[model samples]
Target: MAFDTKLKQWTSLGLGTVLMTGALAGCGEATKPADTPAAAEVSETEANSHAGGDHHGAEADAAAPATEAGEGEGGVTIEAAYTDPVVYKSAIAIAAAHVLAARDAYAEGKTEAAAEMFAHPVSEVLFDMEPVFASQGVEDFTGLFSDTSAAVFAGESQEQINARTDEILAALDKAAESAPETDMSDAMVSASVASDQIERASDMYVLSIDSDFYETYLDGYGFYKAAELTFSQNEAAIEAENANAASAIRSALALLAEAYPTALRPDSLDADASALAVAASEVQLELSQ
Candidate 1:
């Protein structure tokens, strides 16, 4: 049987059921979007960029969705949204994405928020994945996450933080060497992670409709960022295999970027997040072929 099929069967009991993306949120110094899509954190240029692009260009744009914004929901944590079946390498990549987000936030003076993204994953799953790493002859590097989180909290300079980020990211890469072999194509795996994140992002957007949606909005923001990065990394392969599927993924990412414009929720919510879901659904159909 295909690994994904078996993975789905194995994960059905735990993956979707855990639904604790929430644990990832409000975790940074305790931290912590909107209408017209402009009410969010987006620039007019970013808003315009989503209009069109070739496969590679669109994929790049998707991954670079500016913070002038925003994830859809299940507590909205990228850790929960994208790593269910636990593609070891991709899970580590997701961790890298969170670190990148934290790096950017700290550069922008949002240190507390930075700390949250930096530390949560170590507790969430990175440490627990030790067995897989040990089995593969990889050492425990999860401690780096906590250490880096502390540095960011301590007001480390951007240069220092950048170095720390690089260090941890390198460790993650080494650990990914242990990711179990799978029957699925790399395109299939990347696409699957993208789909999971967008699905969760859609759910989070719905929850953001509430008047008390601060943390809820932040959750969605993280998911969207991670989703874009996941899809962009393997984009060329996915495009070569199925041009239509790749296009749909880009379109959905553009929609997600608009919906999740920033960490700060707007006073008025004005996004048709369903459009994002429909776009993701189209990509799924393409993948099923």
Candidate 2:
């Protein structure tokens, strides 16, 4: 099985889960309409950063209705509502479709076509986003696929894959729940090690592609090895650890974001290049730390 395909499926699920939860107030409730036109424009990313940590589950409780819109002293309790499930699910489905399409192409002896599908826009996006993700290392990268209790990328067959993908969509159909803000201790160490390691692997992969795909493949495995270790090791213990890492990572991400466009200009990479670059940077930092 192609590793990238599995990785993207899980990552998307995790991202989707976090995003949905952060948008609504109170568990599992239908969101109240925003009081003003200004309130409606808040970005999901900005909203989640403000939501605290208690609500990070892969799925939120379905029966709970969101609280009425009110101005709390600290901030307004805003509700999250979406027009259609099709929008988000369709985007993720495109990834699945690419994987299945690639598989079909490979089976039909159109290896180049299959590889191109897997390696294009999606790959580029992952590469671009790598620097931000590198903090969690392989554990974050691989965990994208391994959340068996949550997403279905763990399934061994196409049927299972489709089922899991659908399950993720169904979960998205419920009202978006908001998580409390999370502490950054665990994320920091994981991010550092994963970042360093992935960067090394990416550099190696780029350099050795012509000489040794096997070695490059091994490098990929090695990078994930570090990621898994960092991710698993820091899991529950993070709350007690240092909170400084998040700020540092945010700084690093800001820096990385600025660097992305310039890096891709000379290479003429497709969309996936940015994501892949960022992922590699994330691993590089983790391994180095």
Candidate 3:
């Protein structure tokens, strides 16, 4: 599950760059400076056609000095760069940088701080639904009590859930103490942190289930509706929460580590990174279910 969450965050954050870049074209922010090579590659003939009289007539009246002066500049001037296909700008690059930085923090064991990098939109989605899931019993959610749900509640029993969770914590303590002496580079660290963020969402599943709760409260739709509220309020967070199932994943990883510290071998986090990306996509899908 942690694998899934981490993969999802990475994937969504990655794809978000594309979506944001595309959207930014409408706002005229995705365009880079005229001097930038990305902008320079545009053929003047093609550019001139795009910067035709009709397009500039309205802007000519209200054009700022910079816009007016730049109009005559040659080889894809910034003012003339506004039409059609949007180019990648520094803003998209900056967003990518932040995500990379956050991921670095996590891999280095700065778990608390690393969490701050979580996409807020995803957080909002999960925050709204989590409380409701905790409050409602499975019994009330007959429509939702199925294979997927069962897997989600795999270790919900009092004896197994708490016990297994405790084991994982203990293992993490050991890992922190025994981790290899290699220094983590910025990129490696960021990827690892992102992995942890997605992995943490499992907590919701662990805490929400109770054997008896399922007997009396069985309205899956009601619980699902609560999740929907979460998505509406904060889609990003909800996505993260759902993908990582951090609580449950951490517990499971910890328990597995206790038995065999290398069970999931997160030390080599490439696999985990990919999984985190996928988990994010799944989280979005799960909310609909």
Candidate 4:
């Protein structure tokens, strides 16, 4: 799918979340709490069941930017990127970022948010990765998602879900080893994943600018969260390999952080849509170099 088309699909999917949250918040929304790290995690995470992952998937035939943009054998996770190992690994990393965010939501007493985080990837990313997993000769870690999500759905404690998070993330790491042979450094691959997330954040942010629904803002925030997490995790590697790229990502994330301060919709755009797009573009340029 083209980027524009995927953005439309994201908006459509986020509408469902607006409805779901209206039910969840009820009178509780009367409370005016400051952002608790991920205060809007529940609403935003749910809003992005398909939005976050499919940006990387639009490359069902390719991972490149819609006009721009994976590969492993069995079946190409991304047709255009079949030979590029990083795109495959980056795809897996994006899903892990979502799961990681869920763990945080769980620790912060946001079980519903945590559950949505765990559950979305099952529908949004797993099936898409099957072909690449097979091609890479990695064991199918699909069950990890089910096992972890079931724990969340079962009302498991944060510690228990954390254990499950460990399992799912580890399995994803193992699966990432399947990308076809390549010369790219691991840091470069991580940077690519960050770039993908940024691209998605920019896309979702675009939707929020003209929409009335809070979920559109949440959709963008989810991807921004993912991008932030990915960059921080890989900071050492990214910096070691290319300080300029690391700085580029850091700056872009700073702008995004200001723009998406929380999952709740703001009365107006905090960061101009063009600014967000420029930040994403700059970061992509740094990584591409």
The number of the candidate with the highest lDDT is 4
lDDT of 2 at 78: 24
TM-score of each: 0.65, 0.23, 0.16, 0.66
**After superposition, candidate 2 runs with Cα above 4 Å error:** 1-190, 238-273, 282-289
Worst 10 residues of 4 by lDDT: 22-31
Residue-level lDDT of model 4, residues 1-289, one tens digit each, is 4323332443355322322331122111122222222222223233232323332222221322322123222122455445777667656755775676567666766555555555455335444455555566766555555456556656787778878888887777677666777787878877887888777777767655655544344545666787787678789988999999999899889988888886555688868778888988998898777
Q: Rate the local accuracy (lDDT) of all candidates.
A: 0.56, 0.30, 0.25, 0.58
lDDT ranking, best first:
4, 1, 2, 3
When summed lDDT is taken over every stretch of 10 residues in candidate 3, the lowest stretch is 84-93
Q: Highest TM-score, which number?
A: 4
Query: Model 3 Cα displacement at 73 (Å)?
Result: 58
Which segments of model 3 are wrong by more than 4 Å? 1-160, 185-193, 196-289
Q: What are the per-model numbers of colliding residue pairs?
A: 22, 66, 52, 8
- Summing lDDT over every window of 10 consecutive residues in candidate 2, give the lowest-scoring window: 52-61
Which stretches in model 1 have alpha-carbon errors above 4 Å? 1-86, 211-213
True-vs-predicted CA distance for residue 124, candidate 1, Å:
1.5
Where does model 4 exceed 4 Å of error? 1-77, 105-113, 211-219, 262-269
lDDT of 3 by residue, 1-289 (tens): 3323432442344322322221111001122222322111112232233221111112221221232333221111232122211101111111222223223333444322222222211111221122222232101111111111122223234343234323432432232232222443322322232332322222211211221221001111111222222223344442454544333333333332232222111322222323433553344343334
The candidate, 1 or 3, that scores higher on TM-score is 1
